[model samples]
Target: MPVSPKIYHGNSTPSPDAELAALIDAHPKPSSLSEYSYGTAGFRYEASLLPCVFVRMGIFAALRSASLGGEEVGAMITASHNAEPDNGMKLADSHGGMLDAAWEEHAVSLANAPDSQHALALIHTLLSQHTSTGDGGNSSKKKLPKMVVHIGRDTRSHSLPLAALVIRASRAMGATVIDHGEVTTPQLHHFVMHANGHMLPSIIPQRCNESGYCEIMAMSYAALLRTGSVGGKGNVGKQRLHSTSTLVIDGACGIGALKINQFQHIFEKLRAEGCTVGLPTLHTVNFPGDGPLNDKCGAEYVQKQQLPPRLYTPSSKGAVSKRYMTSFDGDADRIVFHFEDEAGKFHLLDGDKIAVLVSSFIQDELRCIDPEGKAVKCGVVQTAYANGSSTLYLKNVVKTNVVIAKTGVKFVHAAAHHHFDVGVYFEANGHGTVLFGPKFYDFISAADAKLRGTSRHNRANIALRRLRVLPALVNQSVGDAMSDMMLVDAILFLRGWDLSTWSKLYSDMPSKQAKVKVADRSIITTNENETAAVAPAALQIALQAAMDDMISQESSGNGPKPRCFVRPSGTEDAVRVYAEANTQKGADTLAYEAMMLIYKLCGGVGAPPQPLITNRL
Candidate 1:
């Protein structure tokens, strides 16, 4: 017999006591007592340990909304690439990104409260601190701020109860909860950003089958086809491309699989509008049915393991050996590209390769938009974990300004926005997107208008036109798998290169990554860009000494340069160490020694150090 959880659910309206109270009463803190901290990706763990956290997050979410004067905020229920039983929640701001850094501490305090009553008291305190009735602090005359929270969740079993708890807690505080039911992580971001009038005041279609996301993506594809160069061929304008490109997708049997199914009809709509670009045929694998979510599949699995998702069989990989394939994480936010060569060896074109391709495609056009490089500068933003080779190419070959940011998406996104007209940011983990700043749009639009007025069939005119549309193709709010896939397909079509050509742009230096179970991972704070350690500065000295020792031992002077760094894993209870060298053996040795050093100096638990994952591709 099959059974379902009997958690209480509510819509926009708040419900009465019994059911909501019962659910809260049943969920207590974890028996093992893991300290809860709101880190990079929010609090994630086994589902059983997350219910109370969800309940408190809902209250803090309401307070966060109040802080913004009741502008609608978003709560996304997803662990994103974690195991089946693992579930998590992320609070999105009114601006379509993660919770404001300002509110993070308040959220952590609320989540760590002793009980629901204590959590409630904390929420009230937050309200009193930030809430005002136009008259300074008079408690008797103070009125609660009206808040609205837009909530969405991915398709996880634990998500159902957790979502219900969110609704209960939020509505109990008199906040309106617009339940978005099931959606990808990025889709929720799109919806909130759209609903909050951040981008445009358009209504997102209500029915799942009629979602306008496919249409928006199709527009991006159409924009590229109308003006982009393909294999040196001039744009045919409304004429269809003679050849069809195909992409094989690993859906990870999760939310991404369901979303991709809605896109086939989008091409027809574009054709009706007289832009006849051939739509890429999407062959989806691991589309959810009986399989568990993210079970040996998805971007995280492939990236972390340095292998294809277990569900991807050779036959389904690609009929031709030279085809391109990609995978999306559980909620479809991050993506990784993989291809099999003639000899059947797998090659990965991760975030690093993707950055190189994109920066190259736009650099010349961006330079022309502001020739003096005075107001509109184009650049690439990378994390410390980004491959050294990619950084070098962007800085030297592409001749674009390169900036390094902290390890998280929030940090990278900010750097991209403030400094560059065209900001291409990506973590080596395959989480990334391009940011077209305010000046980028103005410059590209002006350049296109001038070019259009001058020449009807010149290459500069076509290039300028395509450059203008590239920004729309990107979902600037956050990293999106669908948006990124379309952008990649467009780049491939423009370059007229198969996966093999794309892979040859630059080879990645061999690198290895491992995790050590530290007694307190938080103690491992980092320097400015997370490239060095802040506390016990000796850690940096040890890391640099190890790299120097390895380089000195290399017999060949032309070997790959040695580099290493260690940082605490924001999402886990372990510290992660990254090392790279010319050869795979050198990389392995460097990572091993680095992990051991951190384990010995810092308080490592259990055995010496355990290797979490390594990728030498």
Candidate 2:
């Protein structure tokens, strides 16, 4: 077990009133407030001001919960892999997902509410309604029990104090609270669903209208049904005869361990029910003090050649030699799969492979159920970061439409919701999600209906309930490790295919991504004049000219055309450089050469002193 860090406070503990006073005193007059804004990632600010930003976030959490019938709320305060100074807040509903856009707008309205008192009053009213006791009078009709709010933070230094402020605010509002210290966002979601003593009964006389409850109920049913069906049909007996399947989980020090444990426990129960369960056997890397692995250790770091021994060893004669391996990043919201081939070689199942496998599975399964066998009308969406091979595979091989969007899970998620029956999106970084169309949801729900009023449905639904547990999914959604694991498991289980086999479908182009910390985050931007304003105009011109020259030379087709995207880091005061080409050597050459040019134009190879420049590039 890892030793937890001690919570320390400065000489003085600041009260909300005192904290507000101090903030006002330090900042004095209010700036226009236009500088602070919210996006799909949520409200972000420098770590120095996170204390104040959290106060605002708390208010938003309360308001959103209130508007949604006073359900419980949660907030995440750590920037995933961003530099120390960058921090952000994600406000989650009771289900652990982002609040709907309308709710976000409402939160913004409350945040910008004309006066402080008005803002505070609006928050107070919502908190009161969510937690209100049915004490006499007409209020009884509308009053509800105090909502329970769970708060979790990441590894950043500022997360603890910021979390403290959030906890204090919830307690102040009379809402019951759970502070899951140092948990990954996905672990928090798992805690929200399966953990005991985590849920509080609603005080409202009317039945609670939580959006996630039905989803949870359905998941529980799905898990039970699937397990029972396998056990009842003697699938486990056949599995026992053949030997239990083995799976290796590499939790990249993220919160996904909890979900994997849940799967293990659930599988154990199935094994006891005469199902042949094999190994869960989790190998955790990147725990505290182990040093940061970042992209190098998790899915991004896994190359085709790195196969763990457990996945390679054969069990016995006449037994299937298939073994599975998966790894998750910091929060366990995304995942990548690995497997060993017959020749003892390892292979990676990148997002493209996952998309191909999932798209095919959905299409095939739906066709089996639908007599017409008409196309499912589903499309696959990806970002510029997607491998060129993936695009060709989807169109020519799978014969499905592919839509490429800008980088970011937000855009991908939105595309999934709006356009297709089954929309798949992934960042080459390994973040992905499968948006089940209403028809698919109904199909699954209907399949579940056949086993209604039985333990089978109840057990199976536990697994299925995960789909409805969106608050945690949404809250931890951005590049989450846990959610990704659960998602991959669900899809693989449904498809009944080895994830490793899917990676062999196509070869990927070599790619590389690097980051350079600039003196000022504001100095780097896609905006032309605004970016020039922060850095020297001459330097900007030189950098642009150099990039253009590189693009032109690379486009000549003597070698793989090198492509690069240079922009300011959203989560840090740095410039990010991403380059891809036909070969690893070409990709590295382009990145290195670009960095050299930028550094030369700026005056030196190393970062400037006072400006505090650092380059992972």
Candidate 3:
């Protein structure tokens, strides 16, 4: 076994052991809660076991801010789409993204410390590494500003108490705290990014506050509508968009309900002044007190079940056939759209669908503005979970570069940012956003200057105008459900398409997903992008056999090939298996085959997984 490397402070002041120890002692970890890991959503667990984790994460955020020379960091208290009793936190870096990967290891170390003194030791080690002592090149010797941390939470009954613990621990580290009470996760991300100087004043031109978020989103949306509306000045504006004036939002009975209400009010105020045309009338359901958060409603439920939320049955007022409907996860960071057919069937328009729609629109607009598709690089980033049909559509139909990343949104975002000038990324579960790189900003600004000097009714000028305001409507720091909803709506409106029309852009292969419990989840691993199993030596071989057998048994016809993969979940103690094929029956059989293989080969713990379907495919 290798020994740990020695830690050095490099002449910094001694650690604040007394304060750290006191803080740690005050928030004691439960005896039964022995191990903790910083999973995709941070240190999540039953609310009762999270107090200690919250306090430690609070201190971690404070130190993280200090490491960035006093730039503000954020800690958002939410377990997006999890049940109400479960809660967690996600740290935002100064630039308004997830915490850096290097620091995630340190967070795990801090959370799993055995005692207060042990926690102090870990804190001291991290503090030394993070806290800078000397100026790099400046001779002026200006002092570093006080450390600051921004905090926000969802509507869970215990979220406020958890927030208090964070505030307490952060204060103990001499960090200033900005408590943004009762806000959506994306709103908090917006606040932290703006507070830390991500203000694109030329593009957004608004104050750095909650109202500023509303103003920027509203103004940009109105600009898109006014530029792309039907019967307007340009040839492009004559499309029959806005078939309906109403949009029903399922807010998951969480903070998104409150924020959507606020956004609707602001949007209507602008519409009344004739600033926008064909903006929808908002109808919000699953508001707080109307139901328990995420209890059979939300993006996760809708996307996974491929059905309407329990509270949003066909008879519900918002369930009008063919009308557009969307669902927000508990904290509103992820969103998925669906509609009830005239025959009362539920259909989901998931992230893959959204990615295709958005990327196609951007590519179309860029073609009009640049004629040659060379000025801007556009691409879509997805995960192994993306439907094979979507990957084909993206590469063949949309004709843009498509790549896969690991399952987390951060990994997908990083891949998108690295690959394209105009990168659009989304998880199959609907957590994602459009990232505009420096090249995109430069191209659009130059195009705007050129177009404004020419005819305003021209197609190039119209597309340029819409592209100019597009960035303002997105939350650049992270995925914001509200922002993405606006993006989908704008694309649908400009194209004059309903959910049915949009869904017709491409067909999805029938797919199935299942989770298998094992004695040790760590024993099951996968290659990068999680497309194939690598560990448990026999796992991949067995899965491949299943896939080959599946293919040979099917009729050779003009259909997509069957595909499947198994990977350990980053956030749970189980392994997830996903499969898709041209037919729903084929998908169910392949998925069930793979599930049984893992259950037997990977030390399955609980009862074996059930049959995926009752009838033969």
* Model number with the top TM-score: 3
RMSD of 1: 4.7
Off by over 4 Å in 3: 1-17, 133-145, 198-201, 230-243, 312-322, 555-559, 614-617
Model 1 over residues 1-617: C-alpha lDDT tens digits?
A: 11121222322323323333444566666667656788676778788888888887876777788778888788899988887788888878887788778788888887777765565456556766787734342222455466888777888877978898888887765677778778888877776666676454222222121165566666766777655433234333332232326677888888888778667566755657765654567777777663677788888887767787766434554453235688899988899999777677888888888888888878765554455667577788999888888887887788889999988888988899887878898788778888876676667667766776665356666667677666556766788888898888777766566678888877888888778888888778888898888876778888889988988876545434778889888876688888888777888889998888888888888888654344443
lDDT of 3 at 318: 49
Per-model CA lDDT versus the true structure? 0.73, 0.52, 0.81
Q: List the candidates' TM-scores in order.
A: 0.88, 0.64, 0.92
Mark the regions of model 1 whose C-alpha exceeds 4 Å error after superposition. Answer: 1-26, 133-143, 198-210, 229-244, 268-275, 312-322, 368-375, 555-560, 609-617
Better of 1 and 2 by lDDT: 1
Score candidate 1 by TM-score against the native: 0.88
Model 2 compared with the native: what TM-score?
0.64
| lDDT for each residue of candidate 2 in 1-617, tens digit (9 for 90 to 100) | 22232222212232333443343233221353444556656776667655555665664564455444556666776665444466777666665445666666656655555445555555555445544433321122344343556677776667888887766655443345666676666445444433222342121011121223223422432342244233332122122111113556665543444334554454455557764322233333344334442334555455322333121212331233335667665455556777666666766776767777767645544544453644345788887667667777778877878887655666777776677866766666667766655555555566457446656334344333333332222222234554455445544543344555456677776666666655565644454312122354554565555546656655535333446555555655566666566666666665665465445443332453222222221
Sort all candidates by TM-score, best to worst. 3, 1, 2
Q: For candidate 3, write residues 1-617 as lDDT tens digits.
A: 11121111111224444666777888788999768878775778889889888888887887788788888889999988999999999999888888999999988888888778788767656655666534441112323336888888899999999998888788767677888788888888888888876445467564456778777887788778777653433333534444446778888988898888777888778867876664777888888778889888999988887878766333554454246789999999999998876776677899999999999888988998887899999999999999877888999889999989999888998898899999999888999999998898889878877777777667788888888888889888889999999888877777667888887777888899888988788998789889999998798998898888888877536556788999997766788989987678888999998889888999887788888872310
